[model samples]
Target: MDNDPQAQTLIARFNKMKEKYEEVERFGRYHPDYSTIMKEVRVSKREMDMHETIAAYKIKETELQSFLDEISQIVAYSVSDKIMVPMDGALFKDGGCGCGSGGGCGCQAS
Candidate 1:
């Protein structure tokens, strides 16, 4: 998507419309151009989201985020103390990420 002309065009259009929307918003709801600019913003956003490559990328991004969140809960990767929290029951019983050597943060459970 980095070098795709269509993606770049769509992104530029969306960003331009978004900036316009923000500018109009500061002028309050009574601004005459507010409605028109808002519509443009919505259209550009929808156009970008409906693009095949962008849509697929977004879906994969969401899936990866969900997987990361689940991992964070099941392991101690996101914890301050590196203590693994039991998901359903428990993941590590050795305590403190279960990294037996105390080598680093996070669990080493295989």
Candidate 2:
């Protein structure tokens, strides 16, 4: 909702991907030769691999978007004080440095 250009771009991309998926679904459902076309398609190994890669990326993009949406909701709730626990310091024990027993870089739990 903010005037962030990156967010706007991501939203646009997501919308375009959704439209493309709908179009593909419609085509597969209505086209008489849809199965035949898929069976007869003669793609090289590289092309097939790229297609798989693109599909995987599309799925990951959707998952990442969902995660971001969840995170945004959590942040909104936190800002509104709907969440009781303070997320910042609630992860550690005794408010001490979070270094583990090894105590190297304070990156681990003690």
Count of clashes, each model: 0, 0
Q: After superposition, how far is residue 94 of candidate 1 from its true place, in Å?
A: 30
Which residue pairs overlap in candidate 1's backbone?
A: none
User: Against the hidden reference, what TM-scores do the models get?
Assistant: 0.67, 0.29
Residue 106 lDDT (model 2): 53
Best prediction by TM-score: 1
lDDT digits (tens) for residues 1-110 of candidate 2: 23545444555555555555555567785777555444333222224325544446657876786677667668878788444333322345335446543333456545
In candidate 2, position 107 carries an lDDT of: 63
lDDT of 1 by residue, 1-110 (tens): 78678988999999999888888999968989988998898999999999988888888987786677578776675556567444432344344445665536656666
Regions of candidate 2 where Cα sits further than 4 Å from its true position: 1-50, 81-110
Worst 10 residues of 1 by lDDT: 85-94
Candidate 2, residue 80: how far the Cα is off, in Å: 2.4
Q: Rate residue 32 of model 2 by lDDT.
A: 71
Over the full model, what C-alpha lDDT does candidate 2 score relative to the true structure? 0.51
Off by over 4 Å in 1: 76-110
